[model samples]
Target: MLLSACSSAERGPVIPFFGAYFPSWIACSLIGVFGAVIIRLLFIKAGIDAVMPLRVIVYLFLAIAIGLLSSILLFGR
Candidate 1:
């Protein structure tokens, strides 16, 4: 029963919409930049003094790292 459950839990392929037009490296980098811009803008507009620009950059870097790692593991040659 445990083995059956584990097998059943395995996921099928995920189909990306609009197809995989962009390469993972470029896609991840652009997404990171956009996310950083949004975060910085929101923090500034909200007057959140504690949320520095560096924090946004750090968050962006982490996001990009995760994305790149996932791409390499899941789609690399």
Candidate 2:
């Protein structure tokens, strides 16, 4: 029984919408993807994308960064 008290909490956030529940991470991931798209478009408009040799990899990293950032800001645990 004492060991139970030492266990780390794993209660991640959840959102209930339209009578359904959704994990918060999923929402953050989608937000990250959207942000990545906007950043990509901005880079394209500024003519910076043309100089990047690793477009796909860079975009993937951008999405991951945004996702992690959102998780930190929203979860903060």
Candidate 3:
């Protein structure tokens, strides 16, 4: 499969000095913020319920936190 081939490629080891974990956190935060904003705007424009925006944001944050924590615990210094 394509996925298997990609995994076989020689990706270098993770570099901790770059705050490798930080980028994941930042990306998660940005996605949560932007996604929430866009969803709220769309809901308002369409005159629908506003609760979905909050739920989406919360799920995004949770997912990101879980991923970051797992990575740190698995590859910590």
Best candidate (score: TM-score): 2
Q: Give the poorly placed runs of model 2, Cα more than 4 Å off.
A: 1-10
Query: lDDT per residue, candidate 2, 1-77, as tens digits?
Result: 76775565845588888999899889889989999999999999999999998999999999989998998998773
Cα RMSD (Å) per model? 9.2, 2.8, 10.7
**Worst window of 10 by summed lDDT in candidate 2:** 3-12
Candidate order by TM-score, highest to lowest? 2, 1, 3
Candidate 1 local lDDT, 1-77, one digit each (tens): 65785584654434465865444566656555666577657767898736556674577676676666655666562
Determine the C-alpha RMSD for candidate 1 after optimal superposition of all C-alphas. Answer: 9.2
Which prediction has more favorable lDDT, 1 or 3? 1
Worst 10 residues of 1 by lDDT: 8-17
TM-score of each: 0.41, 0.84, 0.37
lDDT per model vs. reference: 0.61, 0.89, 0.55
lDDT value for candidate 2?
0.89
Q: Model 2, residue 18: what's the lDDT?
A: 98
Q: List ranges where model 3 is wrong by over 4 Å.
A: 1-21, 49-77
